[model samples]
Every structure is written in C-alpha cells, then in structure tokens.
Target: MTSIEPEQSSELVLRLKSGDVLAYEIIYNVFVKELLATAYKKTGDRVLAEELVQNIFISIWEKRESLVIINLRAYLFGSLKLSVINHIRSLVIENKYKEYKQVSFQEDYQDTSNLVDLQDLSGLIEEGLNSLPTKTQEVFRLSRYGNQSTKDISSKLKISEKAVEYHITRSLKRLKQYLKKFYIFLYL
Candidate 1:
C-alpha cells in the first residue's frame, strides 16, 4: 500500500509516465476504492466523493509526465483533502446566496405597491411644480386644488382673466412635458 509493493512501483511510475495504459490501469485498480472511501468519509456525500475520486485519477493521469511522487497513496489522499475543502467552501457560498435571496424576497413582498406608487407620483408632481414659474405655479394650484374659477384667480392676483388662463395653460403644458416619462402621466 505504501508504494504498491515498493519495488515494482518505480517501474510502474516510469511506465505510467511514458503513457503506458496498462500501468495506469494497474495504479487505478490498486488505489481507486481506497481513495473513494477516504473522499466519502471526508465529504459525507457519496456522489460528490465519487466525482472527486474520479477527478483525482484523471489528474494523476494528466500530470504523470511531470509528477515526482514519493508515495502515490499519500498524493491521492492529499488531493482528496483539497477537493473536500473546496466542496465545503462552495456549500458555504451557496448557503449565503440562499439567505440573501430569501431576505430580498421578504423585503420585496413587504413593500406596499399602492403606497409606493402614490409616493413616487407625488414626488414627480412636486418636481414638476418646482420647475414652473412662481406665478404660473400659484395660478395652477389655485385653479386646480383650490377650486378657484379663472376670474376669481385673476381678480385675487390683480391680473386679467385672459392672463390667468394663459398662466394655467403654460403651467399645464410644462408639467405635462416634465411628467411624460411616467406611465401614470398617460392617463392624466
């Protein structure tokens, strides 16, 4: 087990390095089951352990030409240790992502849709009002929200009724253009 009988293993390594399929098969047959068991014990996951063992064999075959192994059994087990560590790290990252998604879903569901929309629309209206000239904004608020007639607005402000109508029209046109980006503006 230490060196596959310690005498023939050097010959086996040389042949395996020279791309001898039979030597590779002999090494795999000797070590695969033990490696699989070690991987399974470390990972506690049968499928992942089997896959890790398979990858270890594949790595040995791929690196045969460059390898300088004093003990093949130790090398395979060392590879298994690294694979198990990587698997555990991936599980931790996956758990963190699941937790993040769950928190995001709860936050999304807790938000009141109507309240959000109303707040957004009010903000847009306030921004549009700020963009208007002071007199036009005053005329628009009185005519629309204050329920004042155009003649009353003009009389109170000491302007002609025609001038009040012009201010209201200008303010409405400017606000319409400013709010055009919002979907609710189409209905208004």
Candidate 2:
C-alpha cells in the first residue's frame, strides 16, 4: 500500500468530501491496485475482484459529498472487505436458488416411473378433498378439476369472489394439513 502522510491524507479526504474530482482521481490512482489485490486475495477471481474494486471507486465517487473518511487506506480496505463479503453471499444465494429450481424441475418432469406415484397422490388428494366442508370441496373442485376461473365459480355458485377464494384457500390448507403424512411429496 502506498503510504500517504497523515496531514496529506486528511487534506485529500477534505478535498474528496468537497467533490474535488482531481483529489478523487489521485486517490483512485493510489489505492485502486491495492484494493484490487485485496479483493482478488479474498475472492480468488480476477474479473470479480476487479469489478468489486471498480464498484467501490464508483460508490466513493457517487457518495463523495457525504463521505467521512478519517483514514483513506483503512476506509478503502473496509469497503473492499464488505464488497467481497456481499459478493460471496450473493453467489451462495444464487447457487441455492439454482439448486432449488433444478430439484423442482426434476420433480415436475413427467415420466413413466412417476405414473404410479401420480395415481396414488391423486387418490390421496381426492380422499383429503372429501374430508373438507362441502362448500369448500365444491369450490376447490370447480377451481382445480373443472379448471373454472374464480369469477365463473363465484357467479355459478351465487357467492362472492372473496368467499370463493376463501373456500379454496381453506380447502387447500386443510387438505395439506390432513394429508401431511401420506402426501410427503406434496410438500415439495
């Protein structure tokens, strides 16, 4: 790291807070490589580290007017650490979402092997539906099996749309609760 004298560093920080583009350029030139190296060491990805460092500089420039920096080097390193951590967290979340989507797609994919499971699940679902209140069971049947829209079901049943929605929601919740043990796959 290029060491700037304490007085000079403080002056540069004041100039940066005043929106002096020259001071900002000087700071960037001095700290960019060090920040890049720090990010690269942590992330172990050249492109990502470069992007992180670039983003830090961008943020500093954009928020320069409100920035309060007692020590330029320390502030730059702190920013780099935070950016790296956030990047890692984002990557982890993205990977988890991808995994979830892959598993969901696999489960949804139809195959001859799942035929028996589908039939059994249908029978179990029918049994659970039968156990619901008559109005709820009817609403659920019209919405799901009959593929009728909520508006159509409400009009046909002489009930408000909100009531139809409530019945369908209640039926689904009850069915899921009642068949929780036998329909383990449904939870996914």
Winning model by TM-score:
2
For candidate 1, list the clashing residue pairs, or say none.
none
Which segments of candidate 2 are over 4 A away from where they belong?
110-188
TM-score to true structure, per model: 0.57, 0.59
Backbone collisions counted per model? 0, 0
Residues 103-136, candidate 1, lDDT per residue (tens digit)? 9887786566556766877787779988989999
Total residue pair clashes for candidate 1: 0
Model 2 per-residue lDDT tens digits across residues 7-89: 88899989988989998888998888888888889989999999999999999989988888998889999999899889889
Best by lDDT: 2
Which residue pairs in candidate 2 have backbone atoms (N, alpha carbon, C) closer than 3 angstroms, thus clashing? none
Candidate 2 lDDT score at position 20:
93
